[model samples]
Target: MSTISETYTVTGMTCGHCVASVTEEVGAIDGVTNVAVDLPTGAVTVTSTKPVSVDAVRAAVDEAGYSLV
Candidate 1:
């Protein structure tokens, strides 16, 4: 399988807990191999084996009490 990486901006993340929450939620998505959250910049990098939909990522962020910008 090929690795795919995508970066998305998120809002409402201000600390380490926020980072962890985003990571856990996004990482739970199917095909997701890794989730990296940059709290200072609110940039989330999702690495997966397949293309993950934007809607899926948005929903995951929402589920974590944040918004995908």
Candidate 2:
């Protein structure tokens, strides 16, 4: 399967725990295979086996108490 990566600017992630929360939330999506969050940069990278919808990612971020910028 081809892997897809997406970079999203996430807000309200001020600490490592916030990053972890975002990571767990996004990583729970069906297509998502991996996730990385850079707290300082407010960037969240998601790797997936299939095309991951931006709306789904945004929803996950929102569920995690963060916003996609």
Candidate 3:
């Protein structure tokens, strides 16, 4: 299967715990293969087997206590 990578900007993530939280929530989504967070830039990159919807990613970020931009 081909993997897709999408990057999103998130606000309010300031530390490792924040990174872990975002990573865990996004990683739980269906078809998600990987979740990478760049704390310095508020960039969250998600790799999945299919294109994940922006709303789903936003919801996951919200659940993680962050805002997706």
Candidate 4:
């Protein structure tokens, strides 16, 4: 399996709970294997077994009421 990591500047994460919510939502995608969010930095890291496309990731973030900046 291929491993890939991506960092996204996410908007709308104001607290740890928001981070957790975003993490869960993104992690639920089929290709996503791991997720980490730093609320203070507004950074979201995603690990996947395959090459997870930016559009797919952005769509998931958008669905969760957030934006991938």
Candidate 5:
């Protein structure tokens, strides 16, 4: 299988804890292999084995106590 990557915008992340939270939750999603968050730009890049669900991503962000914008 090939890797699928996506970038999403997130809001309300203020520090490293927030970054770790988002990374942990999103990285837990099935098939997710890598999660890179750019705090300065509020950009989250997710690399997975397959196309991930928007709803799942939204939920993961929510679990991290943040909003995906």
Candidate 6:
């Protein structure tokens, strides 16, 4: 299957726990194959078999107690 990568700006990620939380939530999404978080920059890059819904991502980030900007 083809994969699509997307970068999102996430806020409130101040530590490793934040990164892990965001990663866990986002990774739980269907088709998500990879999750990379740049803590310093709050850049979250997600790779999936299909285009992930922004709303889903936003909700996931929210679940992690963060915000996707």
User: Where is the poorest 10-residue window by lDDT in model 5?
Assistant: 49-58
Show the colliding residue pairs in model 3: none
TM-score of each: 0.97, 0.95, 0.97, 0.89, 0.97, 0.97
The worst-scoring run of ten residues by lDDT in candidate 3 lies at: 1-10
Estimate candidate 6's alpha-carbon lDDT, on a 0 to 1 scale.
0.96
Q: What is the C-alpha lDDT profile of model 3 across 1-69, one tens digit per residue? A: 889999999999999999999999999999999999999999999999998999999999999999999
Tens digits of per-residue lDDT, candidate 5, 39-67, equal: 99989999999889999999999999999
Cα distance off (Å), candidate 4, residue 17 = 1.9
C-alpha local distance difference test of each model: 0.96, 0.93, 0.96, 0.87, 0.97, 0.96
Per-residue CA lDDT of candidate 6, range 1-69, in tens?
Answer: 789999999989999999999999999999899999999999999999988999999999999999989
Clashes of each: 0, 0, 0, 0, 0, 0
Model 6, residue pairs in steric clash: none
Q: Candidate 4 residues 1-69, lDDT tens each?
A: 778998989998888778877888899888899998988888899999888888888988887788998
Model 6: ten consecutive residues of lowest lDDT = 1-10
lDDT of 1 by residue, 1-69 (tens): 789999999999988999999999999999999998888899999999999999999999999999998
Off by over 4 Å in 2: none
* Per-residue lDDT of 30 in model 1: 99
Q: What is the lDDT, from 0 to 100, of the residue 65 in candidate 3?
A: 99
| Local lDDT at 44 for model 5 | 99
Question: Model 2 RMSD to the real structure?
Answer: 0.7
Better of 5 and 6 by lDDT: 5
Point out where model 1 deviates above 4 Å. none
List CA RMSD, all candidates: 0.6, 0.7, 0.5, 1.1, 0.6, 0.6
lDDT of 2 by residue, 6-43 (tens): 89999889888999999999999998999998899898
